[model samples]
Target: MENSKSWVIDPLHSEVLFKIKHLAISTVTGSFRKFDGTIITEKSDFNNAKVSFSIDVKSIDTNQSQRDEHLQNDDFFSSDLYPKINFESTSFTNVSGKNYKMSGNLTMKGVTKNVELDVEYGGSEYSAQGQLKHGFEITGIIDRKQFGVAWNIPIRSGILGLGEDIKLIANIQVSELA
Candidate 1:
């Protein structure tokens, strides 16, 4: 870890959002209000960077207090038991110009799975405060059941209360540590 440049997520400039199909006809959006992440790299381009991220499960917000409460229950996140969702990157590699592939182990509800996400590097620049910052957009799809979030109520044949596939989108801004 010595000699490596360190960067921490700027919560004010970052957002984590997720979307899932509800009733097979509509999409429900939710976000985690609290998260923390860090990246360590020796090069400015960020290839081979080490990445770690965590989100507070209880912070799930769906714009509805009722639904948010349900999400924190055993049927969904079970936030009381597993309070945090974490990801540790195993590899970060450039796929093409400004695009990269990040593979990591995602742990949720005590289940861990290896997942791959597409990363778009938005380039690095100096912020107004004279801090070096890097921007990245990460997108991916994951099956909730794989993470022990398999709660679903079937409305009818070929229809369910919620979708199994969840889309994850994160607009992350990281500021370099001085």
Candidate 2:
């Protein structure tokens, strides 16, 4: 962790997405429209990294206004009270070529849990602007109820409600800061 430098997320080229099974036959997908993260590392391989990010919960978008609004309310994320979702890396371990195991603390609605992310490093490159950049596709799954978003309503179809599991993904592109 010596001589570490910070690399910032390029918001224009990065995204955070989540999907959950709705009614057992359908999927509800959403994205956090606003987020930012930084990685502090001393090596190009990123094996030893400190990463963190904050996502604006109110920016959750599923392309449906009504559903999106409900997600930001008390029964769900309760964005008015806890407006930010956060993550801080605990460890980043390389599994092989492009594969990695990323463990971190993920918090939502004031509930925090330890989660592991599967990351695929897409390598690094020099951009058209001549900046060193790194790319990654990260994925993880967590139980929504564990995060205090435990809203369940049964439907006539006997579908119960939304599924307990939530799958998350992040396609990130970051540039080194000199």
Candidate 3:
């Protein structure tokens, strides 16, 4: 029993961003400009809805051309070998007012780990173009080493070249498909 509400992700209006500590002194932020996914709702219960998403590993952008290139190399994401980061939901539970806990399998660098996302529904309405749209904001954190992304350099000051934890934030907009 599906919710009967099909939604298509509007990549132009959605963004996937991440942040990590660089040397424990500064925070490095970046985003992937090209990624897309769909949302299929199952109305058995609002808490039973399913969710999934995928991102292109090669689309990483940190506002620096050289760093982006390095990330695509073997030192980091190894975009040539694993081209996509993906997630598929397994369960959902209501946590509190407007907040839901979503557990899913996240695959990156060929390693799959169970991850959770804090989801908040931002309601739905008709857009100016007369299309129904739904909004959601989700946030989660993943340990870089868990996915075999352990490359790092140790500084004499006790800081590492790259942080172990990566913070993920996503603002997604989906249009109702007629």
Q: How much does candidate 2 score in TM-score?
A: 0.95
lDDT of 2 by residue, 54-76 (tens): 99998999999999999888989
Q: Rank the candidates by lDDT, best first.
A: 1, 2, 3
**Residues 1-178 of candidate 3: C-alpha lDDT, one tens digit per residue:** 4545667789988899999999888899999998878767666334766777889999999999999999888878889999999988898777886788889999999999999889887777888899988787889999999999889999867778789999999998998667
Largest lDDT belongs to which candidate? 1
CA lDDT for candidate 1: 0.95
Pairwise lDDT winner, candidates 2 and 3: 2
After superposing candidate 3, which stretches have Cα over 4 Å from the reference?
1-3, 44-46
Comparing 1 and 3 by lDDT, which wins? 1
Candidate 1 lDDT over 1-178, as tens digits, reads 4468989999999999999999999999999999999999977569999999999999999999999999999989899999999999999999899999999999999999999999999988898889988899999999999998999999999889999999999999999876
Q: Report the number of backbone clashes for model 1.
A: 0
Best by TM-score: 1
| Candidate 3: worst-modelled 10 consecutive residues by lDDT | 40-49
Instruction: Assess each prediction's global lDDT (C-alpha) against the native.
Output: 0.95, 0.92, 0.86
Worst 10 residues of 2 by lDDT: 152-161
Error of 3 at 10 (Å): 1.0
Q: Model 2, 60: alpha-carbon shift in Å?
A: 0.7
